[model samples]
Target: MSTATQSSGTGTGTGTATADAADLAPVRTESLAAILVAGERPPRPNALQASLTFGWRAILKIKHVPEQLFDVTAFPIMMVLMYTYLFGGALAGSPEEYIQYLLPGILVMSVVMITMYTGVSVNIDIAKGVFDRFRSLPIWRPSTLVGYLLGDALRYTIASVVMLAVGLIMGFRPAGGVQGVVAGVVLLIVFSFAFSWVWTMFGLLLRTEKSVMGMSMMILFPLTFLSDIFVRPETMPGWLQAFVNNNPVTHLASAVRGLMDGSWPTTEIAWSLGWAGVLVAVFGPITMRLYNRK
Candidate 1:
């Protein structure tokens, strides 16, 4: 009886010690409110800041996928070489002479053609659901589309520089010299920036990237080839000349060609700028509406 009673007393003591140890140990219970509201929230970024941030993101994407630059580099080089050589002999009696007329037009064509990629990019982003997150962000609604155009502006510059370098090497000289060339390039970039809004709208409307590309090509091919990029529009039929005369691309080429040739094409420049403004005014709002709805 005494031994049994001693064993019972020991067991009771062990249980008491375990309970005391547990009580001494730290018991951290985090409050749900305190954890969530730890500190003041950061200030929201303004429109320009958010837009530029997204533009930087687009630049970083090019850095990671350097192949994205092939359109700006190889495509322009090939165009300069192929057209300058092929038409130089047959049309102008020499590649050297033809390049003088062809380079500016080709520069305009190449840059404009590549602008379709903007829509393709938008479609891909939408397909991946990335824009959904962008829409949810506290940012200016149009900033996302603006950021895309800003990024593409760099690509446009790259293509222009590459083509100009090729032209210089191929005996193409600009009478307008440095100032004229700079003005022409600036004008092209501005026009391209406005033109890209059309593609952005298409991107939002189209279901697939391929569909966007197809639609862009269907529209671009006629606009580019029907213009005076390859030959004098006067040589064509009167009906064709009428279409070519009214083509915005023709006016842009004329303006750029005149600038590079050291002549101020005031009328052509005005028309080009007017067309650019019209494109942006019409398509920018449409794109934003689609973007908001999408």
Candidate 2:
């Protein structure tokens, strides 16, 4: 009887100790549950970091679909070859002279053309419901677009280099030396980056990638060809000259020309920068609004 009582007392004491410990210990609340109860959000990445993260994601996409670079690589090469051989003699009296003029214009057109891909990509993502997941994440919304634009910097640079290299191989020499060439490339990239906003807005507004590409092409074609890209506007009618002079593509091409030729025309550079700012101002907000709405 004594041993039985001692055993029972010890068991009861252990149970009491356990109960006290349980009561004294921090409540076994899940961190998530506690966070939810507190109505607190976990800290998210800052704008720059978030944008870079998204940018990295965009770069990674190239691994899975290397063909995504076809426009940047093959298309630029074909354009360079076809344009130099086909129109070089007729436009500037020889292939050599024409390439110097044509190369800069081609670079501008290529960059503008590729900006549409941004819209197409965004549209496809939206269609696939991938954006739905992104929307749910604790990220700065604008970072996604900024990230894509940053990621595409590589594509723009590659296209520019290819055009320049092809032009050089074909006897197109720049008077601007190394410094001039570097400046021209930098300016081209800046313009291209700003121009991408217009396409991003299109992506937000368009229903499908095809529609974005088609619509963008329709708009860009006129902007590129109607300017003084292939031929001088002086030969055209007065009204056509007026339009060409005012064309933004004309200013960009002229800026590129001056840089490559070592002339560095401040007026054209100012105009190109102004237009880039205008495009970003107009399209950036629109794209963000549409994205947030989605």
lDDT of 2 by residue, 207-270 (tens): 9888999999998998898887788888899988888899988999999989999999999999
Off by over 4 Å in 2: 1-43
Candidate 1 C-alpha lDDT tens digits along 26-118: 655666567778989899989899889888888888899999999999999999999989889998999999999999999999999999999
RMSD of 2: 6.0
- 180: Cα error in model 2, Å: 1.1
Provide the overall lDDT of each model, using Cα atoms, as 2-decimal numbers: 0.94, 0.89
Q: Residue 34 lDDT in model 1?
A: 73
Candidate of highest TM-score = 1
In candidate 1 the C-alpha lDDT for residue 151 amounts to 92
lDDT score, candidate 1: 0.94
Model 1 ranges with Cα > 4 A deviation: 1-38
